[model samples]
Target chain A: MPCPYLEYRDTSADQSFDEARAFCTVVEEFVQPMRADICNDRYALDHESHCEIYRAHAEGEE
Target chain B: MSYEAFLDGDPVIVTAALTGGVHGKEANPNVPETPEEIGRAAGEVEAAGASVVHLHARRPNGERSFDTERFQEIDDAVRRHTDDVVIQHSTGGTGAPDADRHRPLRTDPPPEMASLDMGPLNRYDHLTSENTRGLVDSLHAEMVDRGIKPELEVFNDGHRNEVHGLLARRDLADPVYATLIFGPGTLTRPRPEHFLTAIADLPDGATFNTLGFGRHQLPFATMGILFGGHVRVGLEDNVYYERGELAESNAQLVERVVRVAEELGRPVATTDEAREILGL
Candidate 1:
């Protein structure tokens, strides 16, 4: 599943991935697809999550 | 990627090439010539949304210098003013001894990145930047030793082919980053189709940065964002804010590009994101 905080607007003429730039709410920063690709969208998985901020946020909730 | 499975594109990484060696205050008085000036400009550009600062050291008299000490001083000044912007040094030059080209990478804490010209290109009627295969290999080897990522400078299609040649001979770090430059002289022609062709020609998994000289800067930068690649701006590539007026500051140029990216629905990459994208 895509990260919950990953917000994007796809407006490409053909609706391709060309125009989709993602932003992460947890860190309040724009992120590359590489980071967004593996994020769990819910609770962060300790070894699998590429985002430190999302992991910390999930830990705080727990 | 085809939308059978769609994937988000990378955020735009805005790089500010603060001051170029070819021109100085004479071209634009706002071009920073001293360590303090460059540092202050670095901070401003970072605030305006650039995640990387491309640096060129200058002598006290405003001439370009490849001295390691000068690079060190500039790096020190940059750190004093900004928090996390990546620092990239320019190693491409004309008429300099082949050995002196290595000076920029020898600073105490060498730049996190350095430009590596893929091949030779003509500068003026009488001069040529002889970035022969041997020099290119030597520079790439040093960057590898220092853990500095080489931002391959692709001036034309020949240089693009050289990128393939370099990759065939030696292994570069993952996600090979190259800057596709457009302009007169030895640079690729400034046209949308040419830029698209360059993008199409890039080896798989390599990320490209868009740079257009002078009047081509803004339009190409917008296209870069639309195409989901990074961008570079500032007085180094352009001295004007518009056709006739000189740019007030490097920050102004960065600010304009940031605005364009936002309007196009693309978020600007933060410094951390830039590091992640570039593997720096």
Candidate 2:
């Protein structure tokens, strides 16, 4: 089963469910506006590894 | 207890690619999903002569996942069935979050081996299976730090090149294990001709395994046996047992390998034997 949000979101942004947890708070922040929507609940900033999050940003920017 | 079983001079290690990240019960109703199902499947495969289980943890809903808690559950479940059999967790999957892939390293009892995909892969066709240098470096560092072996996954020549460079690096220890996947796409077709040549190209003290997709799975596995290498098999590579027929269980695949090994006069390595061969 894919993340519930995967069907509507960018598939490229789609990763494993744990990845959503591993990434830092940025993606969560990006999806913050949609928190009220139960369909987007998987986008919370839980167990955000500052290292993976910041590095992903740095790599993405590069 | 001793690993002398592999030293009979004709040892052949069989690794079971249990439940892959892509497939579900729809593809094969027997595909293990829950911890209980995976554990039962591990027991069956072990009895059928599989020394290693290549795991791709899945959510309760059958979605591919890498949650640490879930992995721990899977690990414990597998151990409950058998202890000597090595548990190798996968870190590569299409859409796998870069960090989530490494969650295996963070498990309470880290896996004996975790997959480290080398270079890039063109998945299906459109998506490029990317493994950036930073990610590779970070994964290697984590593996070394955690005392877990890297089951290097090489798909193409560029992946071979990456392995070549990695062998020279100080971070990785000697006696690395490489699983060369063939028949993924036309780009990485399982070429039996290059199997030996690829192994020759690896640095000193490297063991290898082969995964042939679809129709090529069993043939390539035989090639590995004849070539003095290891083999990985399960519905993950080819869901069918024959033309248009779905396999009943991973154990069926392992049983076939055992029969093939017998015919070839090569002894299937026991779990203890496999550990020795892997230096675990």
Candidate 3:
């Protein structure tokens, strides 16, 4: 998702419009699918964290 | 144990927001402010078939608060008065900024659930409210640590996409509980197509609720029941009971929701059933 915070903050004139355009162009060129594939890894981490919390609560109840 | 079973039972989970943070005593003489008054109002709504009470604590002088002591008093008072109704606190207390909106959860830990506003919203059409990425991550961490469920509040399609992002990133859990807020001059206008479009974006195993601001509350709530989503109603989001008359109490709003649900042949879900449905 586009970061509204960044959008609100980057309106400064110090960074020229040409510079910002060039930065975006460079980022798009360098982007790779490997970073996008990390979504599954993040999902696994979240699942483990949830299970740990549930296990702790179960133990406390016991 | 599944939400599908609860839906099959035809019971809607009615959440009564007893003390809304926006309105004050001047708008309606019955807007509960003190902890004792809020607890008392919640008790009545529970008796009137509301399974959950969404609370917003106020200072003694009627200002909103995320103070631990104030929230504790309300939580304790509500527990004293009712056993069946689930107590859910709002993280978006008055005067709270994006950085500190989840202070209630941090200080008081968590109740049964806490509100998780999904994304940046142009609330009231006057403010460009931003819930920063860092704030969302921290709030999700707190909820995870405390084992408290989050009631995701989505105000627009962009908000829905934020929820999807959280789910995709695994920041949100299964059977996410969402509430679609509809109002005029907002992202989604108060209408059936808006509701359908919002529902269409929901992921699998997700359950949703609906609330409409102002005069649209009744019609939107009726549509919510027919479409198998829960309903929220109270004077905080609205003042008048009808075209001109003011609402007498929060219980009156709760009663209206119940009547609409019953008229649609949907029974009200109990607190336990609601927990299962929302995966709390």
Candidate 4:
């Protein structure tokens, strides 16, 4: 699952999520999308664990 | 080629720096940290129009490593992933032993090009890179012996002045290429007039590549294109695609420069053309 804060903007021509540039609500900034393989790892806990910004924000919330 | 060629429309060579020694993933997660990641980034940038990939090796822990075996690993991976992009290694570092700096040039097939910082410069608040003349001369000698082209890195005007002394003392291959870096700290100020003056002060017949740290990257790259010089860009220099927008990949940075150059009537040089222009 993608980071709850992650939202896509300017989708790539193929409209692939991996290629789309994204906006992070936590940081209020845009960022390059995470790679498909990294985002789709089934064993990973959550997308926030993969993103430093989201992790930091989630930690702050805790 | 000279600025006169700007009217004649010469091809611009774009170099993508895959990773740098200073910063890493914490700065931007997309900044490749491992050999495999760098190789993939190299392939992506090459396809996006960079003919040369400037590389910096990192330890498994993600700290900078100038070790030969590490560079060899990165080089091998780059070659496996990219078809014909030129490989150029970074020999500049902060506070490393001078002898250790030479290790990057000792890779089995020796890179086609390596950076040779012309003089010393300050990095962060307390660190200084003492690129003494002895180190510079020794590195150049090794590069010459290994048949590697030197990319003289001029961080400030004093370093740029040293370029003249170097040319006088050493027998550099033709079309002397230098990278004029501009930004804060010890680098020349990122200003238009300063860049023009820097280019004007270059040794006659010398080629220049523009490098501007962070937000200055685009404007300086545009200036480089308009002035008939080459450009260096990638996450190594600036991690942002725009203000507040982190760059997606090295290829994303190269693609923008390629587009800018194309719209300005400067065709991007292919790998073969870049080699020919640099006399590689």
Q: Rank the candidates by DockQ, best first.
A: 2, 4, 3, 1
TM-score for candidate 3: 0.76
Better of 3 and 4 by DockQ: 4
Inter-residue clash pairs, candidate 2: A1-B63, B183-B190
In model 4, pairs of residues that clash are none
Clashing pairs in 3: none
Comparing only chain A of model 1 with the true chain A, what is the TM-score?
Answer: 0.56
Across B106-129, the per-residue lDDT of candidate 1 in tens digits comes to 998889999999888875343467
Model 4, B91-145: lDDT tens digits are 9876577888999999989999999999988743434678999999999999999
Interface RMSD, all candidates in order, equals 22.1, 13.3, 20.9, 13.1
lDDT of 1 at B182: 96
Task: State the weakest 10-residue window (summed lDDT) of model 4 chain B.
Answer: B120-129
Q: For residues B1-280, write the lDDT of model 3, one tens digit per residue.
A: 1234335656798988887665556456687777888888888898888988888876554545667678888888887788768878887632255544665675454687888777676533223446665777778788888887888888777888888888877567777888999986545777788788888788876788888887888888887787778888887677778988989998998988898788767888888888887777
Ranking by TM-score: 4, 1, 2, 3
Whole-model lDDT values for every prediction: 0.82, 0.72, 0.69, 0.84
- Predicted structure with the largest TM-score when compared to the true one: 4
Give TM-score values for chain A, per-prediction: 0.56, 0.24, 0.21, 0.54
lDDT of 4 at B13: 96
- Identify the runs in model 4 with alpha carbons over 4 angstroms from their true place: A1-62
Docking class of 2: incorrect
Q: What CA RMSD would candidate 3 show? A: 16.8
